[model samples]
Target: MGRTKPPRLDGESEDDYYMRLIQKLANEKLALFARYQMEQQQEEEERKEVATNLLSLKKSKKSSLKRKQRDFDEDDVIDIKIKNKKKKKVGVTTTNKAEQRPVVVNKVTEGVKEFIKNKMKGSDLKLLIQKTLYASDLNPGQNRLNMPANQLETNANDFLTADEMRKLTDKDKKSGLEVDKDKKSGVEVGILGPNLRMYDRMLELKIWDMPCTKNYVLISNWYNFVKEHYNFLKKGTLIQVWAFRLNEQLCLALVCPDHEDDNVAFEENLHDGENDDVAVAASASEV
Candidate 1:
């Protein structure tokens, strides 16, 4: 038989003692959980505040710039003052996604210059390219993606509808590739061939840098997505990509697996399952 210890005199009852201990532990755990919830609430409030503050700030900055421009039509000195004001770092400027730019074109000869170059063949093609260049929406100096409604042309109102270089007859070749056009649908489609350098060049300019995995979507501001080359799904195709950087400079890209090929490999494995089982049995015998 096990020996029982004697109870202490002047001590609390056993049930009372254990209940107190249980309550103490419960209190501590509750305190911890309360602290976690408080922290989460505070973080959410802070994020909301930041987003609101940034939107208002960007609006103010734009208004201020417009006023200055209006007042001084030709005063270089006033312009210099405004420039200096921006240059003076007053901490993070109020910013917004409304004016967020995807890419700059004028600084890079506008995105559709290749189409313009092709217009030189005889004067007829030249006129078409000329109208496209002059008649289309003029990009805001600040953002190539922006096109005021008035600037859009009759034939090609949206940049998406116009300037589909991929659709130009293969009979006249600037770039060598076959484009599958849908006659019934009146739309063009295909995966974009990889232009690996596009991302690297942006990085070189310190424009953007980010890594994409899963479905890395490049929402081009000015490219014709309808006729985009989807050949990345081909057996062994490759291309470069681009992204915006955290710091206005140092944009970069990396080589990543194409999801299209992953699908192909999965199907191939299914077909080879029988062969794999036979090989496994032979290996088991050898062991």
Candidate 2:
């Protein structure tokens, strides 16, 4: 106890402990600041790398565009060369060969007109359509004649009466035919064969309205007409159809030059058989 030094004061010891705590906090703050700086530096490097990649992509795109332009120019040059070669190959001989081919004139036969005037006592003979029969036309399953709207003559509608036109163009009628008290489905029309004889049975005239186009079809007893003329009504047979009126009724005359002579001996009376009867009502979809 004689040699003991004076005891340290409590205030001084507390002050020393506080100073040590402050120094520890300052060390922790410095470490946190250094970590933040390192993170910011890494982010800057990442940004620089992204900018470089974008620049490289732009350069590649420009090169690809130039390559495409060069390829397109080469293709144009090739096309021009081919055209010049074709022009050189074409000569007067080719034109003369084309000119030497016989020109085919499309005209209605006189017999058809005589049939309309003398036999049927029908007038206003007008060419309706001239077409080569297709497989569909000759097919027994499709027993109807299709008159394409585009192929119809400019005055095709001139043959139709006002009532007939209404029946064909009217959207209200489902079958494009006038329904009367007798339950008639379509216009009662007669089809005259190349032999100048009226069809044994009546036929129906209706319009088939499609999404892209419209067609006037002959149905109802068409199968019988086709069956009777099956020998000459085959596919690829060119035929002319003329429209005329008989007793104010619509009549169509079919003319086939190939079978004109063959059918001459098979002529029947124009007013014979069931020509006055109502046509058998058939669905247009059957064709």
Model 2: residues with Cα > 4 Å off, grouped in runs: 1-108, 173-185, 260-263, 266-287
Instruction: Give the per-residue lDDT of model 2 (tens digit) for 151-259.
Output: 6664556888888877665543577543331122367787777655566677888765432335577877887898887776787787878888765767787877656
Task: Give lDDT tens digits, candidate 1, residues 216-253.
Answer: 11223223321232333222322222221121121222
Q: Which candidate leads in TM-score?
A: 2
Worst 10 residues of 1 by lDDT: 206-215
Give the Å shift of residue 287 in candidate 1: 85
**Global lDDT scores for all candidate models:** 0.27, 0.57
